[model samples]
Target: MVERVTATEETLQLLDKLKTIHGELMFHQSGGCCDGSSPMCYPRGEFRVGDSDIYLGDIGDTPFYMSKDQYEYWKHTQLIIDVVDGRGGMFSVEGPEGKRFLTRSRVFTEEERRELSIS
Candidate 1:
């Protein structure tokens, strides 16, 4: 099955480093203000996933989530998690590392959209 979310090799390596330091981690993307649009990394259970959030698969072993309303706008695309040189969200674990989690996306192909039942 096709994955709804994936990460680059660089990102995977960074995630490994983070996991060693922070233990289990998770990601959340929301539509609210204050870094909500950016993928925020937190130690698992540090961030709560509401019933309205959608699980978008994982990057390495880290589960990724999106707000239900945000998912509505992004469901037609595939999420590509990447790492960039910058300060991450203030509350994110990566903030002190000077590397941020970035979200890149591509519109799913017609075949993939059909397979995923995305209208």
Candidate 2:
């Protein structure tokens, strides 16, 4: 099955470490106006998600969401959650760990699109 979101081994390790400290976590990526378009992580319910957000799938056992508008632009690609040595969004849980969560993407092929039921 095709996944809308996924995390690298490195990213999953970081998430597991964060989970030990923060418990369950959630992720949200809003329009560019929020955190310079970087994805932000918060305790499951710390950040309220409502009609404006769309669940993109889970990465590292964490739910991931994006503003409806943001999803429109990203729908054709797979969101690859990665980690790098740097500061993340000021409010993201990983920011303090001296590492950052980065987003990488790849456009889906026609076969993949069909499997994902994404036209």
Candidate 3:
């Protein structure tokens, strides 16, 4: 299957620890607020998602989403979620852990783009 979003090993480990404390989590990236470049993680049902958002698949079993406008610009690439030492966004769940979730990407290859009909 073509995965639109995936997480690094460090990210997965972080998510596991977070889940134990927060139950379930979800991620959203928007063009506004604190999500301009950072993927904000929230407890499930904590963040409201509407029609303006697009489901981008999951990372570490956590549902991921992006603003539709942001998706338009990012659809050509695959999202790779990683964790780094730093403070997270003010509203994100990872702030207390001293690690922030980061977004890294790779452009889709020709074959993958063709499979997704985006070539």
Candidate 4:
């Protein structure tokens, strides 16, 4: 099956470091203004997932979610999580680490779209 979300090796390495320090982690992406458009990382169970949130799959053992409305606008693309040198969202766990999680994306191939349809 095609993954809706995946992370780069750099991102995975950072996540491992974060997990060692923060225990379990999770991610949420929203369509709200400012940092909300960026993915926010948090300690598991710290940020509640609402009924209207859509699970987009996991990256480095961390579950990724986005608001259903955001999903509607992003469904045709695959989310690629990467880490860049900078501060993350103010509320994200990685903010203090001087590295931020970045969301990159590409439109799914026709075959991938078909696979998703079949699923």
Tens digit per residue, CA lDDT, model 4, 1-119: 89999989999999999999999999998654332246899999999999999999999999999998878777888888888889867889998889999888888899999998723
In model 3, where do residues sit more than 4 Å from their true spots? Answer: 32-36
In angstroms, how far off is 75's CA in candidate 2?
Answer: 0.3
lDDT of each: 0.86, 0.86, 0.88, 0.87
lDDT of 4 at 12: 98
Tens-place lDDT per residue, model 1, 13-97, is 9999999999999999865323224699999988889899999998998999998888877888888888889896799998888
Worst 10 residues of 3 by lDDT: 29-38
Cα-lDDT of candidate 2: 0.86
Q: Provide C-alpha RMSD values for all models, in order.
A: 2.5, 2.5, 2.4, 2.7
lDDT for residue 108 in candidate 3, whole number 0-100: 88
Model 3, 25-57: lDDT tens digits are 999986543222689999999999999999989
Candidate 1 vs candidate 4: the TM-score winner is 1
As a whole number from 0 to 100, the lDDT of residue 25 in candidate 2 is 98
Worst 10 residues of 1 by lDDT: 29-38
Instruction: Provide the TM-score for each candidate, comma-separated.
Output: 0.93, 0.92, 0.93, 0.92
